[model samples]
Structures are given as C-alpha cells and as structure tokens.
Target: MSPFDPFVHVIDHPLVQHKLTLMRQKTASTTSFRTLLNELAMLMAYEVTRDMPTQEIQIDTPLETMTGRVIDGKKLALVSILRAGTGILDGFLSVVPGARVGHIGLYRDPTTLQAVEYYFKMPKEMEVRDVVVVDPMLATGHSAIAAITRIKATRPKSIKFVCLLTCPEGVKALREAHPDVHIFTAAIDRQLNSHGYILPGLGDAGDRIFGTQ
Candidate 1:
C-alpha cells in the first residue's frame, strides 16, 4: 500500500465528471443539485475507502465452503461537520452502511472569523475507529481545522477529511493544521470570493441543497 501523503484525491471518474458537469451549470435545479451531491459523495467514498483494511472470512456457498472478505480490524466512524456536512453524510452512509456516525456543529464566531462548537457527539471508542470528518465546501478551512482539532481531542487512531469542493485557502489551512489527514474532493476551485465563498462554487451548499436560499 502507498504511504498516505498530504493526500488529496479529486474524483475524476467518468460518472462523477458527467454528474459534476450538470451540477456546475447555472440552471441546475436544487433537486438535481442535492441528488448529484449525494450520488457524487457515494462514488467518492468508494475511492476514499479503497485502502480500508480487509480480512479473510470463511463462507459456505450453496454447495461448497470458501473464503470470503470481511473488514479487517477497526471499523469506520464518520464525523459530519454540521449543516452542510450533514449533506455529505447521507451519501457516505449509503456506501458505508456499517460505519458509525458522529456529529459536530460549529457556528462561525462573526467577530473572530473562527468556528466555535456548540454541539459535539462522537463514538465513545473513537480512538479505536477510523474517523472521517466531512464537509461540502472548504473555503477558508477555519471551520474544518477547528472541527479536526476537537475530533483529535478524542484521540482517534486516524482521521480523514472529505469535502465536495475546496479553494486554495481551505486546502492550505487543512494542510497546515492536520497534515496527517487524507482529503478527498470533487474539485478545488481557483480562489475564494471576497466574502470567503469559493469562486464558481455552487453557493452555500446547505442553503442550495436544502432550499433555504
């Protein structure tokens, strides 16, 4: 297996690209947007979890016995970064059916431009599980860095970060704060807008996906 670098996997699979093309269009409906995001997340999970450890198990066929596959050692737990992260969770759950779930909610402190958590619930044995914290957009990555810091407090054996879209600032932030993590995304946009949104980003993922905007 390859040693994980500052891992960043951009899903360029054909199906994902086809769906993303539609997603990036100006007229894509909110319904399609949400659906695509979910679908893309599931597809991304396949690659993101490709390196998950596995074990051999004995299985009996209708007529014969054979060895089968089972997950090795540790199980996975997903930490949704709240609001938009919940959106990614739904899709991740579809693919990672057996993974445990955690939720961390942080509201940005307007004055400090930092994230302050108001809610956090994680697996009791988080240190024994492979944890992945997810969010849809990584504009400034301050929120992600905070979320990761809090999760690390639980001492998980390992942590991976996933996002749908990201900008350079966000990527840099995560790299600086948590270089041990693996990051997966559909695309990393060129830059952040004046107000901190990713340029050409689909807009507030929570708002667009939930029809709040």
Candidate 2:
C-alpha cells in the first residue's frame, strides 16, 4: 500500500453500507445504534483479518483424511482505545474469541482537542503479536495516532486500525502520521464539523452506546 494513496480500505459490502446508513440517522435509538455498531464491527473484522497468516495441516474428516488451513500467527491482540472502542471489541471478540485484549484510555482534551492518555494496559510480548486498534470514529486522528505511537513503542510485529466512520481529513492525518499502519473503515464521511465531530456521523458513539448523553 503506497503512502500516496494510503492503505485505507473502505468497506462497501451491502450489509455494511446499509447498517451504516442506519447508524448515521439522527433519529436512531441508542439500543439500535449499539446493535448496528456491533453488527458493522463484526463485518469489518472479516476484512481486517483477510490477510492473516495461515498454515496448512492434515486433518481427518468423518469420511476421509484431508488437508486444511488454519490461522498460524501469534494470538492477535485487540486494543480498544476507550469506552467506544469497547463496542467494537465485543464484535471483534465474537469473531476471534481466542485473541487477547488490551485497553488504552485516552480522551480528547476539550481545550486543545489533542489526545490525553490516562490508562493503558496490554498483553505481554507485544513484539511477537499483531495488534488491531479499535475505535468507532477516526474524527481528528489524534487518538489513533497517539494510541499507535504508544503501541509502536512496544515494537509489535505489525499494527492495523479499524473504525466505523472516518473523514478525508482524519484519513490524511493518520496516513501522514503512521504510514505503516493500514486503516479499515465502513465509510469515509464528508468532513469534520467545527467542533471536530464527523459530519453525518452517528453522533457521540460512546454516549450512544452507553446512553450517557
């Protein structure tokens, strides 16, 4: 994937697009929003894990012996950025129940709009595992950049980012900051509003998920 184009994968599967349309509606209920987010996250996981390493092994079927392929890399580490990330985490875990999980608590600073890290914990031996960072929105890209920068410090074998929605500005910011990381999203919305919220986004994902606001 060239930095010129950025390795951003936009999921256009009909189900994904249809769910995203539901998510963007201002009238979507909190329960419905949460459900759609989880469904979309599970769909996105299929694409994210598309390139995972695999190895073939001989297996005995009920009728005959056969060779089959199974995922062959280190157990994946699903790193959730915070409260909203947990929503995606639920779906990702359903797809990879054996994978480990980590959490990084970073909230956007109201004044500077920069990421402020408060909590971080990850599985051991990061250098041997592939990590996928999960968050619902890549609004300003500051949180993704900051989270990956921290994860990169641990020298993981590779890293990828997944989100439900993003914008061109957010994509450009993340690509410029971390060219090595690939981004996967359901849709790239129009732009960020003045207050840094994604245009036509599903509103505050955490609040929608948890009914906080």
Candidate 3:
C-alpha cells in the first residue's frame, strides 16, 4: 500500500494486516467476514483514540492511593454511516462502551455515484464530544464526505474517519474536501473500479457483512 496522503493513516499492525488479508479472500463466509471486521475495528480503535485527552485524578488502588488518568470531559461520539458502519460501530462500542452513538443513513446512486441521504440523527451536545465516523469502505468517498458535511453543522470538537479499506481516489477526495479531518484505514488498495468500488477490496462491505450478496 502506498502513502496516499499525510492525513490518511494506514494501520499496519501485523494483526490488522493479517485479518485484512483474510477479509479480502473471495470465499470468506458472511459470519467470518463480519467477525473479522469487528475484530479489526477493535484493534484500530486503539490507534484512533491514542490522542484522546485525559485528566488525572487521585484514586485508591489495592495497595495505596495513586493518580490515575481518565478520559477528559464528555464521552466521544461514534457516528456510524448506516448499516455497513454498524459492523465497525459494534467493535468500537465494545472498546468505549460509554460513547454516545449516532447514525447517518446514505446510499450511493448507481447511475450518478452520488450519496443520497435518507436519515440523519446525532446525540445532543456534539460540540463537547469528539466525533469518529465509522464506515467499512471509502471507495468513492461520497457517502463519507456527505456524512461529515452534515455532521459539521453540529460542530463537534474534532472529527476522524475510520474505514476498513480505501483507495487513493477516496483518500484524495476526502482530504481535498475536509483537510482538517484525519482518515484511518487498514489498507489503501490500488484504485477504484468503474462502479466506484475499491479494486482488490473485500467486495461490497455492506452486502458481505449482511450476507445480502
């Protein structure tokens, strides 16, 4: 995988790479695909939240009192990009159970390859919470871009985008559109197909995760 952009972080942990290879296999079952995606998300969550602010407080330990660091201020907001994003959301929530959840429903128009939003909802007090947008693929970047554009209206403290896979086109499009937002992905594939799907990607993430294909 090539470095597409500075703001795009390609997670290269051994485990992350291993699981991504498994997910890319053509014969991987729906059960395995979904399971692997959740596990992958959990592993990626570590890097995603690495810079989260923390506050120190004195706490009682088993042996004695000591200063402990905890997440500062309000809980994070994990916004899922509808059905496909829910797969990643599950793993992220398992890591940060106290996080507030939100959803943005969008679908790609096959003819125009544009994102059409049908639903949008978010937790209250977004201004106080850092937002992490989760989706499995960033093929065309349409859905991710549109979703983030709407979320910006709420004015969250910060924003990050997480996807299982992406291509140079996707990364460039998103970076050009939202330079302030960082992107985290397991791999950046060769390129996108004519239909706006990532080449060598693990097929349609939503369809594979749901066994719809």
* Model 3 stretches with alpha carbons more than 4 Å out: 1-4, 72-74
lDDT per residue for candidate 2 within 115-191, as digits (tens), equals 99999999999888899999999999999999999999989999999999999989989999999999998888889
Local accuracy of candidate 1 as per-residue lDDT tens digits, 63-116: 999998877333899999888898789898898788999999987676666788
lDDT, residue 133, candidate 1? 91
Per-prediction TM-score:
0.92, 0.95, 0.97
User: Ten consecutive residues with minimal summed lDDT in candidate 2?
Assistant: 1-10
Sorted on lDDT, highest at the top, how do the candidates line up?
3, 2, 1
lDDT score at residue 124, model 1, on the 0-100 scale? 80
Relative to the true structure, candidate 2 reaches a TM of 0.95
For candidate 3, lDDT tens digit of each residue in 1-213? 246556889899999999999999989999999999999999999999999888899999899999999984346999999889999999998888889999999999999999999999999999999999999999888999999999999999999999999998998889889999999999889999888989988899999999996
| Runs in model 2 lying further than 4 Å from the true structure | 1-6, 72-74
RMSD of each: 3.0, 1.9, 1.5
Every candidate's lDDT: 0.84, 0.91, 0.93
Which candidate model has the greater lDDT, 1 or 3? 3
How many residue pairs of model 3 clash at the backbone? 0
* Model 1 accuracy (lDDT, Cα): 0.84
Give the range where candidate 1 is weakest over 10 consecutive residues by summed lDDT: 1-10
